[model samples]
Structures are given as structure tokens and as C-alpha cells.
Target: MARAGAVNYLFGTRFYKMAYVEFGNPAAPAVVCVHGLTRNGRDFDALAEALSDRFHVICPDLPGRGKSDWLQDGLAYQPPTYVVALAHLLAQLNKPVSWVGTSLGGICGMMIAAAQNTPIKKLVLNDIGPYIPSASLQRIRDYMLEAPERFGSMADLTQHLREVHAPFGLLSDAEWAHLARFSARQVLDPTGSGKRIAMHYDPKIIDPMRAAVPLDVDMWPVWEMIHAPRLVIRGAESDLLLCETYERMLKEGAEGYVVADAGHAPALMDYESQARIKAFLLEG
Candidate 1:
């Protein structure tokens, strides 16, 4: 079973709420899973359930996404804001936690893990690494900017997700359906129409990203500072985390796993993917 909850925190002078889902007993070892840009905590449903028996798995929707409150200033959507908010979340949990982050979430994890006395005990970066090519950043920015504002129906939304997230690897119809169900929400159409489906996140969240694109994202210094045991998961076909980068990560002492036939990311919805992640996190 999963329980949904929210935490209210002050980001500058404004207060925002971040929503999250929890699985398993709170007394168990904590594992925090964070999603990519344009994705929410629910994306971890299958993975969290798989690990629930042995871990207290927590998946949080970063501010401006899912059930979390959108920031008044779109610029607040950067990694710094997320670091502060997530730090607050960790404080509330009051435990050292293993971290599993995907894409942009992985970047946040890296920043936090690099900090002095971070609570992260183990780190798993999914489909992302310390260095991101400028081309990949530009590609992601274009995709987000060109996304549709509304969909006529859930099927339409599902189709769109399938096309854009083709890199999520091979997911079953049921799995795709699960993604669609949680990826959107019903809202009154702007034209005084009945109702329409909209992406769960705030569109303005892309503001800072638009400003940062076309430039490589470099974080090797941060990566070097992290002393926690690390695991890097990359899609074999992913342009975001190149093979050379993956090899370099391995040489730098981080364990690596490549998900074949996937592109930007490998959704850990499959049994094998979940098992690999589980085994790593459980390692002594």
C-alpha cells in the first residue's frame, strides 16, 4: 500500500508544498526516489512497490510538479530551490537515506550529495551523469517548449507520452496506462468548455531551463566531492549520458549499468530493472 502526504516549506518569502508518496514501514531504512524534469513522484510507483518489503521508499514531486505548489517565480524551479526543499524533507524524515534520482532529479541528488555532511548514504543516478552534453540539454528544452497545453482525452495524452518517452524502454499496455493516469489531471478548459486533461506540472517551470540550454551542464567537481557509494544507470542508446561518460564514471569508482534498447531513460517499471536497483541499494 502507498500513502500520500505533503510538506510545507518556506522558499525565500513564499511558502510552497511538495507532495510525495510513501511505501512500506517508516521504521525501515529510507530510500528516496526523485523523478526527471516534467515527471512526478508517481513515476516511481512500480519501483517503490517492488522495494517496499525491505525499504521505506519515498518518492517526492519536486515543487511545480504533480501535487506540489507552483512557485510564484518561475526562476525558483532551479536545482538550488530543490536542494533546499529536499533538505527540509530529509530533515523531517530524520534519517540518512539512499537516493535514487532520474535526469534532472539526478543533478539535484549530485548537488546535495556533494554538500558537507549530506544525509545521503548511497546514490543511484538513473539515465544521467555529472556531465551533460549541450545538445542533449537543447533537445530537452525544445521538447518541453513544444509540448501541447491540453489534450482532448487520456488516450491522446497517453499517445503523446508514448511518442515522447519512447526512451523509457519497452513498457506494457498496462504500464503505459499507469503512466498516463498519473501524468495528467482533469481541468476546466480555458475556453469555457467542459473539461480537458493537462500535464500535472506547471508550464512555467521551464523558464530557467530555457535560459540554461545550449550550454553543457558540468558537475564533475560536485561528483568528486560525493563520498557515498554510487551507482549510475544509463540507457544504452541515451544521448544524455554518453558511453564515454559512462565509462569515465566507472573509472571514477561508481558502479554502472546500461539498459539496452532505451534512449534518454529506462523506466524502472520492469521486474529486471527494479531488481538491479534493489540489489545495489542492499549491498553492504
Candidate 2:
């Protein structure tokens, strides 16, 4: 059920491998998807299938996550490098593409949209914005660092995700199973347990935070600079994207909507959310 491919980007002298999934016709209009922090490209499998008939969907696992190659220098995992890597990915397609970014992914689209002569035609920012609350960042930091290294079974991993990500609103059992299938990779079990499942991403991906200093940067100007049509999907109780910022995004002409009973980030797995995105993309 999974159809993913890899591409290599030569950064300086070394090459980095990026993993992404594609669905639908290549000749159709393209939609480039990016996942949130600690998540891989497979997170968008549902959304990709829903939109595939009308759009060519590309969902990438940012470096250090999913099937993508990990970085030797953790500092290079910043948004700017991601933007460049994505641009290269799209350039290979030789066509402009719409963007759907969630959390850290949204910030990548913002940076690319603000740059000169970019290929982003439309943007979807999911539960994130310029003024990221440091509180949420700290929460993410502590949680990832303390998460269990691996699970004895896929069921165990799914259960862990259920408790930790309950704020993504209620997902059906099938949905959770889908997530668990992609979230872990089979590895040689150290305890000779016959190939236990481990998280798919590099644990060192958070190393940048250890040596980082705090800074507050206003992103109103950059947000304003983007000319493409935008849609902002906010989880009702999201600690990431504030209501005030969502309002400002609306004032700046970006369409806005809320996914009730959700928090932090709304996973676009539900019917209502996919339908809204479909309508926006098809708006006349």
C-alpha cells in the first residue's frame, strides 16, 4: 500500500538522501507535502490518496526523519536547509507545486514563499506560524528526549502514540494502525527478541537545541510577503498557533478554519479536514 521513492541532493560535496511518497498522475498539478517535527512523509498517506485523482501529490520525510538520510552535523537541520532541499526536489519535477506543510513543515513553506521566484503556488499551514510559543517547543523537547527508544511490538508503539497524541482528536482504530505501520521500522533486536520495531527517525535530530540560544523574531513581514493563496487549519486547542495569529492571517487574506476537539496540530486524516482542503484547492 506504500509507494515511496528516494532522491539524492548533493549538498557541497556530500549527498543526502530524501524519502518521499507520490500518488496520482505526474501530469496533473502537483502538491508538495511536508510533515511535522518527528513525523515522516507517510503521515500524509490519507491526504495524498484523497487528492491524487486531481493532483500529483509529493510528501517528503525531511532529513533525519523517516527514510531520509540523517545528518552528520545536526545544526544543518534548520528550516533554511529544508527549504533548499525541497526546492531541489521540486526542481527535478520541473513544475510549480502547491504546498501543504504542518508544524515545522509550515515554516519551511513560509521561508520558500518569501524567497524570490519560488515555485510555491498555494500554501496550507497546519497549526503553526511565525511566533512559535517557546513553551510548546520546550514540551516537544522534553517529550522526544524522554520517549522510549523502541517497542517490543507494533501494538505497543500504537498504544504509546495513542496516549501521547490524544490531542490530534479521535482517530479510528484503522487510522491508528495505519500510523503505527509507518512510524516504526524493523531492526535487529539487541535483546535477541527477533527484530523489534524502533522509531524510524534519528534520535540525534534534536541535538541543535542543546547548543541553541533563545531569540524572538517577528514574522509578520515575511508572512505578508507571500503572494500565494493560503489556507490555515488550526486545531481548536492548539498551543502552537495562537488564535490571535490565525486572525491576523485571515486579515492578511489567508482563508482560515478550525478543526474542533483537536489540539497542538490536527492530523489531516479526518474527512472534514480533507474535504475543506479539497474545496479550497478546487475553489473557483
Candidate 3:
């Protein structure tokens, strides 16, 4: 297990630092795992640890999430800005990488993999696809907008996460604990009396989502442009990635895996999920 490290870079004159964790030998094949919207790289801890024996796994905290710096402009949270920031991170790695992404992270990977001369060698989209239904988008947006800003204690916050992320599947108590531990930070109470626990990510990240709630997200052209062999993981009960879209992805030459008893997204923390991802990434 490698300790966390920070990568410093500039995005249009704004200096920012992105935090990341690494695992396995530096010389080993690189695998970059990105988290979903409102999630940080720590979400991949279990998966990264499991793959450390054979692959160098890098999980990065995108801007406004985890230990990374928050963008001054909320609008900068879009995919284009993420691509630029991730490009810098990839440049620092200086190696071809397999990408494992969840939701927002998957969208980023799709865009990068579709680009000319991209460094991505293979792509794994976890419970996300090229097309996002309007209903799903609205559901996510509503949840973010209504999320609590403060919690009286870690236990309270943990309970909140359990409810909000129940769609992540049947996580064990330990798994839920891990999510709670890394998903929040202490912040001064609004009353200016003491401190309270708050969600780890910047709330401003929802700004762009509020500004534009598109009828649906269509990225099929981007998906069509990608040449890298890919795998799509979907939660059997996911409202976000419909069965129709998953089937279409398979028809378009992508391998597919479905996790039962999960919704919206499957947490790749379990042994079976980790094994499936490792096998796909190791393929020739």
C-alpha cells in the first residue's frame, strides 16, 4: 500500500493540487481508477489494494473532491476541465494506462479514450454508458441539491451515507464504515461555536448541474470513436444505466458484466467485482 501523494499543476494560470494514492511496483503496468460525481479517489481503495500485486494502480481525487483543491469557478467542474486536469496527471505518469471509471469518471474516460492519440489503453466503465437518461439526471441532481450540509457526528454522517448510497449495493458494515470515514471532513459549525462533520466534496460542484439539466446526455458519437477494447459494468437494478443501454453497449463490441442486488452503481470493492475488473484489464 502506497501513501497518498499530491500532484501540482496549473489549469489556465490557476495552480491546483490533485491528491492520489498508488499501489504496487512503480514499474508495473499502470491502471488509473477514477471515481463518480461527488466521489473521490478513496472510493477505489479496496480495488486498488486487490490489484496491487500485478498492476500499479493510481486513484486520483478530482478537483473539488477529496484532498484536491476546489476550483474558484463552479463552472470549471465540467468534463472539459476534468480532461485537462487529468491530462496533466497522465503526463506526469508518462505511461499508457488502463482506466476504470464510475459514473462521472466513466464519462471522462470515454471522452479521453475517444480522443486522437489518447494514452488510454483500455477502458472500464462502472455502471455508466454513453447515454444518460433525463430522469436519472434529474434524480441525481435532486439528491445533490437536497443533501445535508452538516452532521452532528460521524455516526450521523455514516447513517446519511448509508441511506444516500444504498444504491451502491449491499455493502458490508465495514465497507459502509470505510465510506463514512473518508467521505467527510470536519468543518467549523455555522453557529461559529465548534465544528461539525461535512461532506468531503465541494457543494459548488452542483452548480453546473443546476444551471443545465439537459433532457438527456448523448455521447454515442464519442463512444463510437473509441478504439480501445472496453468493459462496461452495470448494476442490475441501476436506474442510471438502463438494461437497454447496457445491451446496446454489448452489441457495439464492448464486454459487459452485471452485478445483481445493486442499483445506480456497483461498488467495485468486493472480491468478485475486483477480480472481474482485473481480468479485463489484464487481457491482451
TM match of model 2 to true structure: 0.95
Better of 2 and 3 by TM-score: 3
Report the lDDT tens digits of candidate 3 across residue range 125-216: 99999999999989889989999888888888889988888999999999999999889998887696444989999999999999986589
Q: lDDT by residue for model 1 over 1-284, one digit each (tens)? A: 88999888889997889999999999999999999999999999999999999999999999999999999999879889998889889989989999999998899999999999899999999999989999998888898999998888899899999999999999999999999998998888878654399999988989998766478878889899999999999998999998988899999999988888898989989888899999999999
Clashes by residue pair, model 1: none
10 residues in a row with least lDDT, candidate 3: 186-195
Deviation from native of the Cα of residue 97 in model 2, angstroms? 1.0
- CA RMSD of all predictions: 1.1, 1.7, 1.2
Ranking by lDDT: 1, 3, 2
Residue 178 error, candidate 2, Å: 0.7
lDDT of each: 0.92, 0.85, 0.91
> Which portions of model 1 show Cα errors greater than 4 Å?
192-195
Cα lDDT tens digits for candidate 2, 159-212: 988977877787999999988888998878767755478888887777876566
Clashing pairs in 2: 238-264
